[model samples]
Target: MQPGIHPAYRPVVFRDKVGGLAFLTRSTATSDRTVEWEDGNTYPVIDVEISSASHPFYTGQSRVLDTAGRVEQFRRRYGDRH
Candidate 1:
């Protein structure tokens, strides 16, 4: 716990544009852009490409890769040794 050597931690907004979601939380990250939150206050906003809101895993929209097909293709290309 050192004084004057740590970045300031304050309330900030994380915005997921693709998912159209925004949330307020404490972070050390900074941004020139700002947005008015539900509380009627402006906070530094950070735009993120992906977040839990829109992430495939979180949204349950992830595709299950066809591993069986890939394995068959590999074996066909290079005959299975075993």
Candidate 2:
């Protein structure tokens, strides 16, 4: 790797809005906001809408779509005249 050619890889805090969870990880992304972590250190904070904590697949809270009902409704509205 060329020196001074790569972005900085530093620790950042990703905060999940829905679950109110924060985690520290290294990323190339940067944020203006800072947060105090559990280790008594301040790091840049990035707010995310969804993460594994509140994700349906990870949390096993899948939502079933009513496709059959929607199809029946569509057929009733524009079905062949019989």
Candidate 3:
């Protein structure tokens, strides 16, 4: 509990460009750009590449790697000689 030693806590808007999701939260992060929120108030806008909306795990669409096919391909290419 120090005086004026901690970063200023304020509301910031995080905008997910890919998912088109915007959220307002309190944090020390700031941005030069500002955007008018749905609450009729302006907050610092911070753009992010990935968010929960577009994330595979969060969206419940897990990415599946082609492990079996890749292994077979690798065996055909290298394992046969060995």
Candidate 4:
């Protein structure tokens, strides 16, 4: 609420490089690159490596860890003590 003490929170476009998706949202991050949004206004663009659109968990492609292998390895190393 104080004047000149807070960084400007403005609309920015976050583009996922791998997913090839873009969305507009407010952020405090600044960038030199700009992109014309659907509203026909240029907004600062921040290229991201991952986003909800391409995330495995959100896309229902969650990975299953091989816990059995890890458990066997742990048992071989430390299970004898317990």
Measured by lDDT, the strongest candidate is 1
- Give lDDT per model, in order: 0.96, 0.94, 0.93, 0.95
RMSD of 3: 3.2
In the range 1-80, model 1's lDDT, one tens digit per residue, is 89999999999999998999899999999999999999999999999999998999999999999999999999999988
* Most TM-score-accurate candidate: 1
**Clash pairs for candidate 4:** none
Mark the 10 consecutive residues where model 4 has the least summed lDDT.
73-82
**lDDT (Cα, tens digit) per residue for candidate 2, span 4-62:** 99999999999999988789999999999999999999999999999999899889999
Model 1 scores worst on lDDT over the 10 consecutive residues at: 73-82
> How much lDDT does candidate 4 score?
0.95
Angstrom error at residue 64, model 2: 2.7
lDDT per residue (tens digit) for residues 1-82 in model 4: 9999999999999999988899999999999999999889999999999998889998899999999999999998888673
Q: Which residue pairs in candidate 2 collide?
A: none
lDDT of 3: 0.93
lDDT, model 1, position 28: 99
lDDT score at residue 33, model 2, on the 0-100 scale: 96
lDDT score, candidate 1, position 8: 99
